[model samples]
Target: MELKQLEYFIVVCEQGSFNRAAECLYTSQPNVSKVILSLERELGRPLFERSPRGLRITPYGRTVREYARVVLRHTAIIRSMADYGWGKKFSLATYPSNMIAHLLADFYTHWQERYVVEHYEGTVEEVSGLVARGQAELGIVYVAQRQLSSFRHILSHKKLVFQPLDVKEACIYVGPHHPYYVRDSIDFSQLSSQRFIGGVHDYFAVEHHLERVSLGAISTRDLNYAMHSNSDHVIISALLHTDLCSLGLNFMHQPYSHYDIKTLRINGCEPFLTIGCIRQEGEPHSEAADWFVEQFRQLL
Candidate 1:
């Protein structure tokens, strides 16, 4: 029932053993067990079941784990604020592509003196989940390839807002040895016979754009999968070594132009994606969050 009890429960769930949890909490195993027993008695359900290897969370325990994570994250945020004399620490979730491309570096560089910035990288769906659950103060994501309708629906229900920052194009690229490299412009029809490496899910813009190009129109069976990864670096690396073509944000390639690669213009398709920030609608943003947004706005 107590916050400390919830903390202990989470520790046990994560560590998977009473002894390990006790060591982590810096408390005696007996005390940890007693507290867990009391918590189970109050809840009237066993939170964990012991197995040969270690403790396993029960079905009910899984539900409790979600709430426990939220509570613990918020508690730590509160404690961090208090420890810093109420100064704000901005927690942001971003996609891997944005992080690798240094999109946030300028903002962080100029604002770190005034705000504490924390960054997390994941797929668009994962980032959305973090923002929805209040784990992150805000999230930056690409909107074109993801199912924005579903995100809109979920955010509307949760009283969250998604605001557009900028609209940018993504381009297709191949290594220097590819046939497309010798041409000033390559016909889109040529792609029908080529293997295209693309993002699979939650990358709404990329996926939707590819869908329009009839990704499945080309036979994947004969197509060599150069690589399938959520990380931009991995995809780029794959394209560098093989004749495979990849779609990427235009800005992502500008910095790496020195590398040996050829960019192909896909006629009839703009290949644009919108980048934006998402946050809870009514929740008050911390000072750090406000400053970070302000800096980002200036950059845009």
Candidate 2:
């Protein structure tokens, strides 16, 4: 009935045991049980079924659990907004690639006068999941043309809208010492036999572009992991030293070109990926979210 009681009920249901839930909530088991029993007494129906296997929410409890989650999320949002009003603090989530290049710095500097920024970096899927769970208000990710359908499912389930920020061709690059650096472009046939240093986090973006351009038909070279790393620095370091090639946006190519690395344009291939922002659809975002989105738009 009360917010505290509802919170306790939800935690118990999630933990599946009174003792576990009590530990999680940092309270005694008897207190947790008292709250749950009081809540059931007030509702005139049992909310859970208990057995040796642990606890299971009853049909009635399941229905309440869904609404309870919404209530808790809204409450947290209200608290966040209140804190922002007292002192400008905002949280954001993005992919590793974006952060590596300081893509969001301009926005952060502009908003620093009015807000404090807390940034989180993760894989594209992980970023989407955080947004879906209300852990983050916004997310940015790069999506290959081929992975559009998979992204659509994420957007659909999360009830989020995707807005494209920029699109650029994905080019192949090798270290400065590689023989390909002397040429403006390399033939697909030449690369077919070469080992590729693909990013695990951006594999979808890489694979989708390769398939679209029929890169597989040229030669059957095995993909070799010269160095596997999610960090952009490590990936770039590996690409700068060996015959292994990497695929990335055209804009990102120029900065690395000075390191003796060069990018080759794929013939008949539109190796482009889109960078975009995602926000939950039909949900009211905080004022901070609005300001951040506007800043991103300006940068794009």
Candidate 3:
């Protein structure tokens, strides 16, 4: 049996649906079913019982799945050992973000002497295309829940695997002197009462959702939308001297700790987004890229 076939079967068992299995496997439903059926034919037993909801693992399927894990794990080890990078250069395309930049720095500083690292920062669409076309070895991107389906649809078309590295909600950032700084969290609608400061390209992915939210804020006391620039320094400057509030990640406070910025979740509006490391499905990652992914994942 082919390696892909076994992978499909195992994933189908995990996800329970042909659709989800196909998505995780980066293939079509019928194709996934075909592979599983092929495996069943070879083994002379049904792996799953079909149903409207999804597939249920048969008793024999459980037995097959137990061994499949061992086989796939060993296969990965062999592949990594046998095809380890000799001199392959590594390229990574990622959307601009403070957390991602810091993580990349850690990896680059640790491996710079032994590996050459090429990094590209751009919009999610641009970097996804870059990695999809083989211009880069991997990609790091943040997809808000609203955009995830379309984003994954695009990646699936390009046959790229989406590996979520971290997940977090976007929080409000204000100076220490702000009245609400002492509060654990702020009501979502209360945001309308604060003057908003934002960056043209936010390192935090919250900007997209905030734009939609600000439309209905309709608060005369607080400035609805203030000027935003490409520079985070300018944005932070406004927050320090003015009553303007901006959106940011919780951990980002450390980088600007001297400025005394505080981060707070927006009640009823704090939706989480998945930050993922993407690579070409079924393709071998360069040793440098694999090492970086491992280290970054560990750091998270």
Candidate 4:
């Protein structure tokens, strides 16, 4: 019925006497006898034939003893593996996330050395789909407030779990060579006269906020769109060595080899996107997946 009961049974069979079995178990003879009786009653069979000479193991007793020993051995192996941090390989998905890139870099540097990490990159919806369809154990994706309703609908339809993370503020990145780089920060109106690069939506988000400020400049229409590309490397490279600037997440303001990224905050707004992690809702999964999520929560 229990590991201790099996242990007492084995000892009684080997020692042949209740007195000797109690000595081997370091307990009173009465306690040893009680445990064996309980085990025999729970099993619906007598494990030993009582005799004044000693105890004799029955055929059914041998069958249980062999299997019980095997169970204990397997349990020990499982505990050892858990104690040593032996975790299963986990597949993770994210939608072109620099946040996850930094988080993963920190994850590798900090703990759990034996885990195998598999990372996949895709569109935000695609990443969510991966977790929904059971292709990935976890996913990280970003959604602005306006898109939250629909995103939640999609996740619910797929039966996935999600928790929103910190908001990623939006900002404009400029090169060291740019004139505005000399100032500690630039005004909201400064963007109206500047040329920009990167996604049109990013520029418009900044422009919309600037319009609300109404510094007598109702039109961000004059703001030049010098370049438009989805590639961060290309935009960052051009911004670094050239006069062109790009709108980006505030966290993206990191230094490159030859230049440091400088950001200018808008006068009245902190334009931000909410990021969240998603996973299957009811699937049987590994503890390693939970551990990985904790690492992100602690660090990010």
Candidate 5:
């Protein structure tokens, strides 16, 4: 199939409906349907099962979807590499964190008119892949100390190196109305009854363990997850409006004070995580990339 066909197919799979996918692609529904029909005819395999109720992706479609995503990601990497150092575009990927978001905000304010910032947020593995594939100049992520050896080994295979910025203590975030608001420290045992806003589980299974110990030695898998999301905004809203607490590092809570969020150290257990940036080994950081990281160094 053509690249456009694969792109359209992936979008349809994500949107789960021809009409919605058409809307997203800014095309007519009939046009999408025609493309899918042509694709199925060529492949001699149905991608979607049609029924009176709705469309369901077939087993073959699920496999194709994964392959299509990899193809698109690789294509993007190629395009990005071809355009590297050509303009003011400075791309960076990062794990979701309020601290990084705040640093980016301040960085943009100084160079908004002069530079083009392409910022992406995801899990640690996703961020590393972006840098490894040359799609991003650098990636910022934190790793649990216990997992650092394995994490670094994986990065080495990807031709990337992680440079530690700081070691952060595990902290729990609570809203102003939370009962723990007045407390300066909370033990993992005391958090058993607390509702948590956990991360959305996906392909990165290792992140679950990393996220669990981010607030110290608690059995977060057994803790009540009131809501799960990958969006920082959603997590912040949950913390502000609901009684949902979040597990993270102390530095990650840098901007939480502005929102009246309290950061309490986890007692009895201390999980030290190294916050750092990853870049392709032997590749010098671009001026903009260095400047972006320098801001973080100043903050940390």
Candidate 6:
């Protein structure tokens, strides 16, 4: 019924013993039992079944435990906003992208007075985890259109919400020397032997676990990976100077135009990339986060 009750209930469920939960909560076992009883009376259901050996969560308790976790997480966010001064710092995490780094740099030019601006770039999964764990105030990420349903389910289970900023059709980027440079469109089958340059943490990496689930049967492993690097300069250099190619959204065409890089559509593969920002669910965005979102939206 109360936040304290829900908090204690979750600890009890995790610890599996009232005494252990009380110790974790820095309270007495009798007090923990009293609170649990009060919560059980209000809900009219036994949260846990006690035995001589230990305690086991009931069927209803399993379900309520998840809800309690979400509620406590949101409550913590609310309290953080109230007690912690926002002017002290702002943190953001994003998937490795040049445009996002540029946007953050631009934001810094205008708002550097706000001390301790933290920025992190990683793969999609890492970005989502950062925001979910409250290590970052906001996260910018992209999900393939085909993967949106599964991605949404993952975010929901993590108690995070995603807001779409823009959607762009998928494209394969290549340099002038590449054979596909003059082509208007190419199929995924044609690139089976082509070399690729991608971020170390990107789907191109062999260690990425979500590629198959996100990209369906076609994966970067099907291609001949020439190199993997985290540096944008290194990846772009390979893409421009070698026969290597990279997968990206159509929006990248303009940015790399001066380098004579081409963004060609993949034939019969209409997969779109949806760029979005994520935050902890049920928690309102702070003023700084809103401003960053606005700037990012404008950039898109």
The model with the greatest TM-score is 5
The best-first sequence of candidates by lDDT reads 5, 6, 3, 2, 1, 4
Give the residue spans of candidate 4 off by over 4 A: 1-87, 97-99, 199-225, 228-230, 252-259, 284-295, 298-300
Full-model lDDT for every candidate: 0.70, 0.70, 0.72, 0.69, 0.80, 0.77
Q: Give the lowest summed-lDDT range of ten residues in model 2.
A: 216-225
TM-score of each: 0.63, 0.60, 0.56, 0.54, 0.77, 0.61
Q: Which digits, one per residue and each the tens of the lDDT, describe model 6 over residues 176-225?
A: 87888989887767767677776765542222322443345366567677
Clashing pairs in 1: 144-204, 144-205, 145-203, 145-204, 145-205, 146-204, 146-205
* Model 5 stretches astray by more than 4 angstroms: 8-69, 76-87, 202-217, 252-256
- In terms of lDDT, the poorest run of 10 residues in model 5 is 202-211
lDDT of 4 at 227: 83
Question: What global local distance difference test value does model 3 have?
Answer: 0.72
Tell me the deviation in Å of residue 183 in model 1.
5.2
List model 3 lDDT by residue over 14-56, tens digit each.
8889889889988898998888888999999888888777678
For 194-281, candidate 4 gives per-residue lDDT tens digits of: 7887543532243433443434344556578888765556776777888888655555413222347677654544544666788888
RMSD of 5: 4.6
Candidate 6 ranges with C-alpha deviation above 4 Å = 1-87, 182-184, 201-221, 253-260
User: Any residue pairs clashing in model 6, and if so which?
Assistant: none
Predicted candidate 2 versus true structure: per-residue lDDT over 185-259, tens digit per residue: 666655555667665545444544554555453422333445556666777677777667776655542332356
**Model 1, span 1-300: residue lDDT tens:** 799999999999988889999999999999999999999999999998977887889999999899989998888756643434443566788776532346466656766566555667777777777787676888877776345677678778877788877776555678875667676445555656666676645545464555444343333234345457766677667677777787655553354366776666665555357777889888887766666666555544
In order of TM-score, best first, we have: 5, 1, 6, 2, 3, 4
Candidate 2 clashes between residue pairs 3 or more apart in a chain or in different chains: 170-271, 176-260
